[model samples]
Target: MAYSLDDLLNPQVSKVTRSTDNLIITTYGARGQGKTPVATKMEKPFYFAFGKSGLSGINNVDFQPVNSWSDFKSLVKLFSNKKNYEQLHEKYHTLVLDEMEILYKYCEQYVASTEGVRKIKEGNGGYGLWGDLKDEWENEIMKIIGSGFCVMFILHACADDTGKIMPVGDLKRMLPIILNHSDIIGYVRGNGSDPETGKPIHSSLMLSDTDEYFARTRNEYFVPYIEDYTAENLVNAYYDALDRQEKAEGTSTVTKEEGDKMYEKQRITFDELMGKVAECIEKMCNAKRDEEVVDIVEKTLGKGGKVSQCTAKQYEAVEVILNDLEEALA
Candidate 1:
């Protein structure tokens, strides 16, 4: 079928309906840190308990007990199915995977058994088996996450040889894969005395990464730490961040000339470029050294030139500076 010149030249504009919010949240912490209870507090939660330990104190949340990797796969399949997806979505707003580490162990065991090996690193084909297991686990979990349901994975924290806290796993490759897919990664902390009550605070969620533990949030509006970790609080924070982002985007528009220039240079929209530049400027200002800021701008974006006047190559250099500054500040 051939189209007319008008059809080819003119494009219809539609209202944007897609959201940039991170619906997949992963939380890791020590045992009895209230991870399960906090997760269960989400609206219309459907919890999948990989271990019975997390189920002791929680109540009133609909839950399913999954003992094996096969069970996990079956659940994923049910949710991924189009016919069943709508029903599940109506019944549950959030799907919680309690003790995701146990699920990963089950995946490891299943992989080993299927390959007729005693361990993941067994025989001459150990690396191949590990790769297969990693792929399988990532594929299955991602399927559930992409099924249009808000998903939360609850993991047990373990320290690596370098003492960096991460989800319990033998394969170091697994952590990055999971974190890459997650929108929010949080660490639950407790074992501190409350100053006011002088009582033990069972748990708090750290939403940003520090030198001691691995955690992060894509939402800039999200607080670095939440003293009370609850499903309601987490959901509220996420929506609030989304709202702020929407408002910011609404005010930031790219002009036709700017859009054309960006296109010519294979660059992003003016608004996005300016946002990055603004962030870099703010960080530089926070450093409180005029001479250092001047040197950085001159070295990256050129001497006496504003970011708005930067070429694509200069913008890339400025971005590199921004990344370095962010890491240094962090």
Candidate 2:
């Protein structure tokens, strides 16, 4: 076929937004951070449990225990079938790969076996073996993602000899591919049970990269960290952030300087808000009696009685109080 000048001259405008439901996400953190439990709460998740202990007590969510790379290939083949994929698409909204580090090991094992070698580096006379392994890994994974299933990868944090934590191992080599494909990479940490409900609470999800761990979110609306982490809460935050961005962009046509100013104005941070709350609490404690303190706390936080239990609106109201107190104290 000959190249067409007509086609060369015309280019379609690409979509500026993507569907939130189909995001490619990777969540990683220390063990017992509720990574698996929180992932199950994601939109109609279907899990591929690759680690031996990954599915011990999980309930209600559909899952398959993947043992070998060949088993994974069979799954790819099954999903390649049009009818089978349709059935899956109907039943599941997200396809989760639990314990991604183990999956990387499985890839290495498969590569080693296929080349009749004890180690992956022994394959192809030590030439292109790593590339081959990476190719196989990315190809198989992308096939499933291309089939329209939202993909979530879960990884456990590994600490280096120097005590730096990361999602490492054979996965370190595949980080580029994972990073390229994923829209969000969050590091989860902290563990506490809700005092009132007795349910497990994942304290926070860190979406910003730090010296200790790797994490990121491409969405500008997503905060650097999410407290009291859950998939539902995360999703709601994502959409709310998206809404704010969209509304900001829609407000007016302006120069870059004006737009940047507007963005900075809208960027009131969690740390800043919490700092204000702390200041207010300290002032009230110093200036009032015990009974007055109780009354003020009840008036501010209402029945929640704790900052963690407060909703977004309650936090906003608290922010208002903090501002008023600052002025009054000054």
Question: How many backbone collisions does model 2 have?
Answer: 0
Give the Cα error of residue 180 in candidate 2, in Å: 1.6
Instruction: Identify the leading candidate in terms of TM-score.
Output: 2
TM-score of each: 0.66, 0.67
Per-residue lDDT tens digits for candidate 2, residues 58-134, read 77989877899988888877765657866877788888888877888899899899889989878888764788788
lDDT assessment of candidate 1: 0.73
Candidate 1 RMSD computed on C-alpha atoms after optimal superposition onto the true structure: 17.2
* Candidate 1, 269-306: lDDT as tens digits: 54576676677667668777556656666766666866
Worst 10 residues of 2 by lDDT: 256-265
